[model samples]
Target chain A: MKNALLSIEDTVALIASRAILFVSGPEHLLRSLPRGNWIGGTTSYFMTPEGGASREDRLFCTTFDDAVDARMAILPPNGLSGLIEHRFAHGFTCIVTPAFSTTLQRYAVDGPALPGLYNQPVFGWVAGVHLDRVGQDVPMVFDGATGAASADGLAALWVALPETAEVDLDIVNLFAPGDGESITFPEGGFDVTNCLIGGVPTNLAHYIVARGVDTTLPLVADYAGAMVNVSFQTVDAENGRVRFYAPVVPGTIYRLARTVADYGAAYAEGAREGSAADMLSCNCILNYRYAELEGRPTGGFVGPVTFGEFAYILLNQTLSRLSVRHALAA
Target chain B: MPDGGLLPSVDDQLWARLLTGELDPDIKTLATRLIITRLRIEVAKDSTVLPTAVQELRRFFVENKFAHRDLAAITGF
Candidate 1:
């Protein structure tokens, strides 16, 4: 499916024509669309074919033309466990949750522990507002089937592919656990005060300062060869507390990510080898900013530059991608 | 027989390691990850939450013909 950024009129025409879509745009522009078979979230930043872009007037639209059937729903606050149960027989699920909301946190902290989550491919991102209006304006996700928008609700779209089609969900993470002190948290949560630094209990905030850790580089944990990242949101040295964009699971070991001299080039190189056909991809907002990806091509993968990414689980500072391979193509 | 021509003994051993929490989730084979992760989650809630998960996971390995061939050497079993 060819994904592109389109005007409200164009997006509306596609919706009117019954295109099953996952859309990303500003709140005002998204609210203008007529109801149809689609789901959406608020985001003004995107990585379009022309490279990085931040446009409120246009919306990034991904049409799942290969999907045989699509269903959209507003998942209950604790409905993540049933994600696979509601999924199509042989397809994937796209989920959108508002950033910094309890809805996102619930999924982040409890998703991996929930049953039946790993049965299907799940891919999507956290809805976010423009950086200037983050605190002033709340991020919103739209249930295009009903044209209803809500900040606290989780929006899910389950797309059914043909029996002959196989879908793959993966991520391109440039960060690897650096060779430094191993860190472990006492409990799993976004906010942390105490952690074990190389088997020695220490305050995370003080450790970050004393060790000169770069907050931009996330803490990396290896999950079955998949490098998952939990990015730093703030280091409250005054309170001796540290906050992360994603939760650091209790049983996991985390280490500071090795520094990348050039984030854009590194990301581009990392994504260069992947096939771009029938691909749905999204990058993190932190990468867009830190890598200075605005107006620059991030290799072949392109879509919304979201607040957070999901590849079966919540992640930060990474590129999440999903692609469908039809039997004929294989 | 598993698809990759690996021995059933090696697969069973790997399965035992995963079920007993002797293997780290980070190093688990993808084919067994979900089942093992769910098993870990259930076992954490109650030690008795093992039998059902074990049956389900065994079925998964057979249905998928997963031998954990690539990981047999890495896991050193």
Candidate 2:
């Protein structure tokens, strides 16, 4: 079975036919389908059979067979991780979370506790806007748990994992931090109006000017061996304040990494080594844009062009994939 | 970092489709292509993504008699 971006008629037939489905595409497009076996999120880009790039209101869906037992859940942001852990604690074959942007985009660290925190392989994308801000482009989620739909909520689809299934979760990242200067924040978090430098909280914009650090380079934080990225939004030298893509978390230690990522190089290496057989991927927006991947191919990747990626952890500038294979019956 | 090797998956034309029958507002798509100024992340493994496994998926939905009832339909309240 393959994951093809369907034509309009085919998409309708697939939805009407009733098949186990997980959908990702432009929010406006997915919203049109009858909510039956399908649950959708929004995105315009995908790595389909046509290589690594396409932007349209097309669906990137995966249909499952009869042997798999599937269940859905609608998790409020309040206790999402716990809900997932509770359901999939015994483990699942596949876990998909096509959630609203509010749940996925608001936090840089992606909240203190997230479902991806679990060791299991999680696959998903952030539902996006493609219509009127009031109705059409509104980000949404369809809770398989309740068989309902809404905005600013989480929809999780869990498939029954085989007793002896060999599940492999993989994330393809292109950059790593180099030995660079250690940058720590103050006891009190620095606001957009200022920054903390050398134990003294000062004007953030001024600090960047004085240091001459490339404001474009994201501030990387090494936490418990995981690399968490903090991207800058605006650095107003006149106002002497700097902003970030997401708010800088409190008490989080950061380091300014001297990173020179080669997307061409990384993509090449991944193409040579990576596999897309029975895999679903959610690629990072950063990777697509930064790597200048438009019209370029990442070999065999096919999934959503997402704002962020989850590989048992919220990851930026990386491609996350989930692979499930049955163990040979012994 | 995931260590598994990534292989190719054939594109399934079944699950996701382009619904032309439905109408959509004339809204502009989100232009977030410029967000990334530089690209970098810790790469330690080969990303292994599997092809779509639709045989069993299609079978599951077919036998289960798949039908979605909205909140109103389910509750009848």
Query: In terms of TM-score, which candidate is strongest?
Result: 1
Query: Which tens-of-lDDT digit does each residue in A261-319 have in candidate 2?
Result: 66556544544443663466667666666666667766567777775565544555667
Query: What's the lDDT for residue B34 in model 2?
Result: 6
- Top-lDDT structure, candidate number: 1
Q: Worst 10-residue stretch by lDDT in candidate 2 chain A?
A: A107-116
For the predicted complex of model 2, DockQ is 0.02
Q: Each candidate's root-mean-square deviation in Å?
A: 3.6, 17.0
**Candidate 1 docking: what grade?**
acceptable
Instruction: State TM-scores per candidate.
Output: 0.88, 0.66
lDDT of 1 by residue, A144-220 (tens): 99888989878999999998887766777778899998999888799999999999999999988987878999999
